[model samples]
Target: MNAADAWKLACGNLSNSESWWEKVIQAYQEPCRHYHNVAFLDRKFKLLDELGTASDMNAVILAIIFQYYEYDPQDRASTNNLAHFQEFASTNDLPQGLRSKVEALLTGNEDDLEKNANGENDVQLLQDLDMSFLGLVSDAFLDIIKLERKEYDFMSDEAYNAMRRKALQTFLLIPNIFLTNVCRDRFEAQARANIEAEVQSLGK
Candidate 1:
């Protein structure tokens, strides 16, 4: 489904305003964004159907829509995306419970991964979906790598390679890169292989 249809489905019975949709589109289309664009959202929306279930499908969709709303290669610590999403939720008069769930998913922290591994399913599904790109077949995975590298074009090769290697290594060190059983079964081995290959390429 397209993002607009997915947004409507997610907003079910809530106020789905054109202005809000326009803002989301604008954010993703920002010039600095390469990987985190409408195409990315469409990919996630497609994958959402394959993921088993979420406690709140609405919140998951919302989280996917807004997760990178405020991305900046220069500001890795920026929380503006979450802040903006909260503001959007409040403005749309969405239920507090739903907003909270979406916030937790968007946070995408290690704690959420732990909860997923411990049997809490919602966050696990969301996180697995986020990392699904890593598990793509070799050619497709390399294509995403090129797009991601464009996002950090400002960085010198040495700096970008060092940072990228560290991030990829962290995934390798994780006992299970994909938290959910389904993802582990489907993508874990290939994801690890892809990351290892990318890390080697970065080193050279």
Candidate 2:
């Protein structure tokens, strides 16, 4: 479905925050966003359905909400959105347990996959689902990163290639790219291949 539908399903009784949700959705829809858009959120939702903790309703709900928490293009650094999410959660009367988990995930460093992959709970599953999209849509995702560089006017081929290589290298260095067994089986090989190919191409 669309962002509106996703918001309804994920946000539940937080219907009063329609304006906040709209602002978030619009941020993802920003013209500069090529990949981290509503479509990305939809993909994460699909993955959550497929591999998330469906048994725990709270887990599933939290996973869906976390996917969009920092997906907004405006929050490129993801700093502001964390506070926004906590406030939104508090106002919506989310339980302390779930709210704490959300805070942990948001406060954790985005680049520290190992640090974030602390537990096998729904939060970890949510993190996996978020990263899984990058593997699944490797080429397109990389293209989006490149597009973002262009938007900022990278200035030269060297600068752009350096940025691209750094991103690829970081992914390659990750110990376990996919957290779930099913996702790892489905994507590891192809993702590695794509990343390796991109890294190789950077020199050409």
Candidate 3:
């Protein structure tokens, strides 16, 4: 199914007010999002379903739903996206605990995630949910990264290499990319291989 249809399915599953999901859909349609658009969300949900990491259905849905709400596809800034999600949660009277977890995943900070490791299952599931996109088929991963790279082609080779090296560093720093055991088992080696290939390509 397309992004709109998949989003409708997610909204139906969440049982949230139509207006809220509508706002989310509109936010995703914003012009700046080449990679993190509806298709991205759809792939994430599909992975969650396929890998069985969707333990807390509502949180999983919300986590994925609010992922890009404050995103400025052009600038790649998420400050507003994060704020808007919190506002939406508060306005909807969602539990603070649940909202917190969703926010953590949206924040996507390695240090923050490590510190917030109190709820092991929930946190792992959320991590796995987000990382699932990285576990896509090799060509798919390259395609998405290429799409992201298109925006940066004007950069000097040195600058681009710096960005690529930073990406490789990030992959090395993560202890385990996929959090859920099943996903970890399925994609861990593949993730490593993909990183290695990218690192080699960058000659870093």
For all candidates, the clash counts are 0, 0, 3
Please give the lDDT score at residue 82 for candidate 1.
86
Clashes of 1: 0
Local accuracy of candidate 2 as per-residue lDDT tens digits, 98-126? 66655656555323223323344444566
lDDT of 3 at 67: 63
**Considering TM-score, where higher is better, how would the candidates rank from best to worst?**
1, 3, 2
Worst 10 residues of 1 by lDDT: 109-118
Best by TM-score: 1
RMSD of 3: 4.4
lDDT of 3 by residue, 1-204 (tens): 444554555445444557787887787767666776777777777766675545455555676777666664346653566777777776667777667667776676334443323334655776676666566678987998787676465677788888877977798798988766777888788778777778888875
Candidate 1's C-alpha runs over 4 A off are: 108-118
Whole-model lDDT per candidate: 0.83, 0.63, 0.67
TM-score of each: 0.90, 0.73, 0.75
Indicate which candidate wins on lDDT.
Answer: 1
Give the Cα-based TM-score of candidate 3 against the true structure. 0.75
